[model samples]
Target chain A: MTKAVSSQPKTKRGIERRAKILAAAEQVIGEKGFAAASIADITRAADTASGTFYIYFSGKDVLFRELVEDMGRATRSQAAERIATAANRLEAERAGLEAYLIVVRDRPMQYRIVEEARFVDPDAYRTYYSEFGKAYADQLQQAAERGEISAGDAEVRAWALMGIAKTLGERFVLWEEGEVDIERVVAEAHQFICNGLAP
Target chain B: MTKAVSSQPKTKRGIERRAKILAAAEQVIGEKGFAAASIADITRAADTASGTFYIYFSGKDVLFRELVEDMGRATRSQAAERIATAANRLEAERAGLEAYLIVVRDRPMQYRIVEEARFVDPDAYRTYYSEFGKAYADQLQQAAERGEISAGDAEVRAWALMGIAKTLGERFVLWEEGEVDIERVVAEAHQFICNGLAP
Candidate 1:
């Protein structure tokens, strides 16, 4: 994958234009998929000249990586804010799951784009999840140490929790045509997470 | 998606040939992905003439769907057999998860092909998971009635458990370079499933 050389915008106009192209790319690629979507299509969606795309991204691949990276940043920051206000690790999990579902519901395209990254740009896909997994494992480890939760394999628990959130977000939020009952879904799942199936 | 109308082969030899082609397609498509794996490549891998492929499958798409469908059948049968031996839902969950991980380890290609179905054939992907999720929810409901497991919302808990198995299989079995410690991973995750993170 060719890395984009132009990292920063020199002026306000340049910054806005770059952001415009990235946003357009996300929509175009997310809908049409990475293979079918063309740079021309993205430029058309952005209402910008085809040449202007090069001014920001070297090519479509760079813009895709950036989009995936941007989603990671956006979700992590959002979850971090919600989690920080929680009383403990279990509460943090609830807050984080709710925040994640909201993000998926609001920006369904971003979720599609990230999933498409698995096939379009394998490295970016791996990096995105690996980084998230690392941070999640760290938090779980700390919680276990503090006796906030039952101790087990932090890495396994982290991945398991991530899996639950991801699958639920896909099945309930993204795929559902009608408005999903996010509150009810979260509350039920939270119960399971707090206390397992043992009667 | 154009559905293939070809019926089963009449002769014993013809049946074996068709089976060989499907096996080859699994390996070829699983390794090279759907877009990159051509019909010719699959035929070559099967050691059959390219024309023989058409005799069995209308095209690559039909063959791909068949492969995915075959995997679902294989997994469900295997899990059902193992789960039957379990005493209750918790034991069933342990057996089911263990069975799933073993399948991933033994037939990693089938796992990859199923995931690739999301992009290659979206409907098949949805049907695969939807059917699994519905059955899982039913099982959970029954278990709750029998006092096998404490269930709050069967659908929510079913999806959560599925998610845990899916992600763990991906990270620990499919992606691991070294031998995966299946016993240890299952034991740790099972503990979490039986008793949640509550202190």
Candidate 2:
């Protein structure tokens, strides 16, 4: 395994350059995929000299791994922020699902990068979801104890809920033709999440 | 997109040869991924000459598309069989989820190949899930009419349910370290599916 490079850059100029390269990388790699997207392409897209790429990272592999990790953090933080305002676990589920769908719509490249990681960097992909799953399960467990939700296996429920958000995002938001009605998807999916299919 | 090869075999021997090639392709392609696994690798695994591979398929891309289609059919058929005996749509959902988890466990290669298709053959991946989603939504719509399940957006519900099964399969079965207690996972997930998290 290639040891991933540091995302942190020291100087403000260095930081801006690094951020540019990272943003360019997400565009290049997400569009062209990890194997096909070359460092030169990324650096070119970043409008930097080819050598500037290595100043921030080791290689494409390391940068791809970082993208996967970055996506995980961004998504989790976004969902947490949305869920923070919810009145209860049920409402939190609704807010979290809505936040996820919106993120997929707004930052489509992040979703592509993370999906690509399943093949490009299996460990990073696993870590990304596993970390998110663990955190989600912990919250679910607490919610169950508080009588905010039904008691069930937190781990299984967490993964299942993650699955719901994921597939719905893919189908309703990403694959939807013409104008996307994310609010409608969130409402319908949230009802299923809270009440399920029981009449 | 390269036109996918015909999965249908003309003769008995042709059927056997094609099946051999597909089974070996699944093993090779699933293990090594689409790009890394060559027609030579697949033929070698099949114990057939490289020239023989051309008879069954044009190239790796065509064969991969076929594999994705095959996986979709196999999973849908298996789930349908299981759901046939279910007393209601809710029961069908349980049987279907269980059936899906078992397929992922037993035919782990198919799961890997389909995931690979997200990058390798985006159209096939979309078609694969969309076809399944449409049929699933149709079932949910009918079930709602019969009052077997709650009235909701069937399309939204179908994809959400599929998302649950897909993620749970990835986490609990395909990624499991050892002996898998699939029944337990199914029970836990099905409970949430039918009743959701509302206390």
Candidate 3:
């Protein structure tokens, strides 16, 4: 697809203004949806003039694509930091899952927006997951070779682990009505991840 | 959420007609997404007059909700049929995951529609997964009591398993570029389900 991020802010003030617009867009689009959410609404939420949006993003589609990419970058950075300190691949998996759920809890709007990308921006959505899946598979493969985790189809295992993390984040964090206990979720899920459903 | 599916077709001919409209609507909405797809587009796909659409459902919202429900029912029935013969919960999980991927392969459009429901009809989407998650946890709890599998937190395990099947279906069945080997996916994932990442 054509690069939707048409411009990049060069100065600190410009960067801050762009970040404000993106944050506003995430909340507006998350609540109202991609189709119903308007650029004016996003700008209004950002407390900026509507014309100012063009200085950062070329259009709504451009801005939406940026949000999808942003979720990937943000989640990866967060997960990577925690994963770095893990003792092994199994430990890394636990850390990564926890990091993912924490991100979902903090910036719930971003989570919703990324899910919306499946419809609004199909290519971006595919790239977001597949790219993450590829990188995740690479890590799992290296782990298996290092004898830190069981040897199996790393790609399949990676997607499965990613799935487990994604759904838990949705059910326990995003859609939860009462107080969330993410620690309990991580502990229980980590048990299953480390030791299957065997009796 | 105001009960968009207004009426149920009574006569056989009416049932047939309504079925035609729904099948067409699934295709149209899957291709163009929920908001961009219009009643006219659905009717044209059905090879019927635009007004004929109103006979079955109230509006696009109702039809979209029905499509989301349809995926859940179809998947559950298919899975139940397979799971009934499985010797234990682990076997049942394998059967269920296989059934899910097969459905994704066969009715890809329906899969897209249900995913779209996350944004198009949030309540229905929540109900769809939560209901399934609850029932799945029930089965896991029962199996745990029977000494068929090790269990820690049934609810957390249920959502995590659902996540694995959902993502695997998306990547292997829905988004695959080459010939689909669903049997391999089922086998590989079932291995992980019965035995996690431990070496």
Candidate 4:
């Protein structure tokens, strides 16, 4: 939330222009990466004057951090809405994984950009996952108290579950051009999540 | 394995020089990232002439790919040795997770470099994980057949288990300066892996 530059746009036109620039930045930065992509490149893609970028973001670093934050917000909101529909914690896990894969398939660029944040803006990258992990762990703790899930290390389980969704999304959705069978993957993974691999 | 420029060195001295350059490149590229790191920087760090790098690597991209491959080899060998001692697949799972965390702790730079390969060299990045995933799935299938673990989708479970180990390594080992207590993390994770979250 560091306004490195550019105050919030007051006018409708200004807001629309800013949004357009961000959308274009996502495409440009996502393709060319943070280092090779320049402000000129972003503005050109946005079809706005080069000066317009400075009006919205201080520089490339600020824009990159903002993109990471933006992706985090979008992903969390999507997961929240999907998880709300589930009957219990177990169902919520399936819902959340399905929602995450769908997001990765639809917005693959944003996913890549968020990962790139690990190098470009380490602080933002750490904060993005740390905050999500904290909230996720809290939810697991509450579910355990309700006997929705077997009691265990909520923090450890939270990270382990997140790992499952993230890796699956990368392997099955992002890597494949074919239609991803997310439902099947979810069903199988859900079984493992519910029951340990014990004989 | 794409020799975009140079071939393998013939003599022992030549091989040592190549190894030195690769090691230096790992330090530089891992620290400054691929785009920011320069040939001169790598050569200087290796204490070799700039011309000598061309004798070992064709360019930065080739060196980066080689580094990715090297990490894969190193990690796989480590996991194989540790897993060989396990009494069964369940024990192997715990041993493998512990070994992975130890590798991350010891070679944090190599881990970062491999991740960076997703952007710098997509083919290498995909190949690294795809090969590992295939082997992991095979082992899971064998274990399930032998009744060492519950039967499930081997591919799905492989990725899930890998995700757990990877995310845990990043969170509990790489990010922390304090003693990571690897044994405790492995024990808690092993329980969840064995019994899952269901009561």
Candidate 5:
């Protein structure tokens, strides 16, 4: 895993403090919620002083928004990489579905937090949804052009597919605690997306 | 619309109070969220006495639960009707999609509330998701057995299709307004479920 090097490179201590604060923020916000989570609680969780917290985050909301964005960006980047190598639409779609399953399965807490924050704050929701959504759509459009899917509307199809992958990932992979056949579920999702159930 | 007719009939005054309280509960909860919405604010919104609020609901959480159930039941009944009328598997699948789209578009606020409550309240989310999900799957199973879908797992197919429909309905129809063509979107959703996008 790459160390998240902050653009504003302060001292090594500063980077470590920010990472500590963000880790604490994810735990606090996920357990309680964005609305109820406070800077005091976050700092307490991180074992950092309140003053140190303000140095990294402007406020609780700002911290939570960054947390949401980071999670979203991470998930999309992973999915983008998995599908990036596919030569055709069907293969790309399959890779994309499998990638999503892997991402949500591996990082359930971070993923759920991103989704919950969607309703807790609309501004954050739009930023995350469109940013990730457009990237996901770009993959779909490439697949569509490869003659993998009968082309009509790439944007609509991409968003629609993103919704399906998201819902299924949340239900079967993220929310469920027990082991799931992720490969089977991914195949099922790919099949459902590529070919409707019609015989 | 039908008059207030529960299994046990209430006085006209009692019924009106219930309606007013429910309406107020929706607004307050929608704006303020489940945790922060207080009895006083809810009653104030309805113009009813705070004491009278308890006459209809045991408390705020109870009212919220009932509000969710009522919306779910209403939507489910409509979907059930549409699914029942279809003679073939394709028709059944198409009707089911149309039924969902109509209910979601017709009652977006209630739909959003139900979806949000699912994230906020786990038990309610499970109950509602399982019930409606099973209902949609049952319809899909009939179609699959009749050779509407390829010879694959019906349950997985059902959930996949439902996932697709749900993602489209919740994300596009309810969340993204004017971003998608309703008819085309519906057609594409059905295609993904029945034929998939694959050429």
Candidate 6:
């Protein structure tokens, strides 16, 4: 029997190069708005051939949208798993915010892309955000059903909570580049929403 | 000798033309994404000559930024006037939300411009949103100081409240086509935020 040679490279180095291209594209899109970034600039930054980029992404918009969807899904997945194990409402709420913060802080480029997607493509925004939002809303509904929280329309309150948490994350926690303790910020926000400012 | 005709007509008309151009620009940019919009489109929509647009704006970017600023200022003015006249914490919250809804409903063009600005220009976004945000924050702060609400951080709570109100306005109340009772939406939002789910 004759041995057959495979055309594809099986080396780990090829995979690393593809990741490098995505990372470079993320950075370029972050610095200059995504609409302004060109493939040539991305390829140059990635230190790869123009042909190599096509191996990873069909185009910039595809890459941008995928980066956004991945980050949002990853954040939600981590939250869902943790929330599933939480003992109470407070713990679940805390876990949810913390999960959001982790994704946003770790992958800020992804957050920016998701935020930008709101204006760029409303359908993508609805699909990406609404799915994650519905999951969180389901959690909140469960808490209300269990009588752990005040009873009213859970969906509206869930939407309101999501809005509040997202605004705070964008403002004080995720966007801050200075030396600041994130733990305290998250704690304050979680408490304020879960229990509120009332005594 | 004939009295020298004042050069002021040119300047006065220029200001009017600039305002007209900006008003038209907001609609065009909002309906068509900024990247897709052109000078010809804006000028034609505004009913002003193409040359008149150049006299006021260097390009679409200049016109868009100014439109955003003007919208921000108008929204803030409504907020400021409401806060200045409010009787109490709950009433102030109501007034503030009403102000936001009225501005958003009356000037859908401005709302679109603000939405676009959030995606494209961070500086303009901050300049526009934070100002209105702070105005709302100040109302909450005063309410807390007067013992109308809890003594927790008013600024943080205010932002949270604003986030909810704005989200509801954007996602449900304002964007939805057809007969949207702005008054009812504002009332429900105010009740939810100020009184919580406790009935």
Which is the leading candidate under DockQ? Answer: 2
Most lDDT-accurate candidate: 3
Per-residue lDDT over A1-199 for candidate 4, one digit per residue giving the tens place of the 0 to 100 score: 6557655799999999999988998999999888889899999999999998888778888788888888877777888999888999999988888888888888888989989999888999999988989999999999999999999999889999989988998988888667789999999999999998999
Record all residue pairs in model 1 with backbone atoms less than 3 Å apart, i.e. clashing: none
Error of 1 at B50 (Å): 0.5
Q: Give the CAPRI rating of model 1.
A: high
Residue-by-residue lDDT tens digits, candidate 6, B1-199: 4432212125776777767777788888888878888999999999988887766666677667777888768877887798788777777777877887778878877777777787666689877767766776776677678787666666567667767866666655555656767676665555566555432
List the pairs of residues colliding in candidate 6: none
Global Cα lDDT for candidate 2: 0.90
lDDT of each residue in B85-182, candidate 5, tens digit only: 87778777777677777777776656666767756677887788767667767766766677765766555666666666666776677677566456
Worst 10 residues of 3 chain A by lDDT: A1-10
Rank by lDDT (best first) = 3, 2, 1, 4, 5, 6
Q: Tens digits of per-residue lDDT for model 6 on A44-135?
A: 99999988877667667777777677777778787888789888876777788777777667777777777777765577887775676677
Off by over 4 Å in 3: A1-5, B1-5
Second chain alone, TM-score for each candidate: 0.96, 0.95, 0.97, 0.95, 0.81, 0.85
The pairs that clash in candidate 3 are A196-B196
lDDT of 3 by residue, A59-140 (tens): 8998999889988888889989998899998888888889999999999998999888888788999999999999999999
DockQ for every model comes to 0.87, 0.93, 0.89, 0.82, 0.55, 0.33
Q: Give me the iRMSD of candidate 4, please.
A: 0.7
Candidate 6 local distance difference test against the native: 0.71
Model 4 chain A worst lDDT run, 10 consecutive residues: A1-10
Candidate lDDT scores, in order, read 0.89, 0.90, 0.91, 0.89, 0.73, 0.71
Which 10 consecutive positions of candidate 6 chain A have the poorest summed lDDT? A1-10
Model 6 docking tier (incorrect/acceptable/medium/high)? acceptable
Clashing pairs in 5: A194-B196, A195-B195, A195-B196, A196-B193, A196-B194, A196-B195, A196-B196, A197-B149, A197-B193, A197-B194
Per-residue CA lDDT of model 1 for A1-199, tens digit only, reads: 5646656788999999889998898899888888899999999999999999888878788888898998888788889999999999999999999988888887888998888887788889988988889899999999999999989999899889989998999889988877798898899999999899998
Q: Can you write out model 2's per-residue Cα lDDT over A33-117, one digit (the tens) per residue?
A: 9888999999999999999888888878888888888777777788889988899999999988888888899878889999988
Model 5: lDDT of residue B13: 82
Please give the TM-score that candidate 3 achieves against the real structure: 0.96
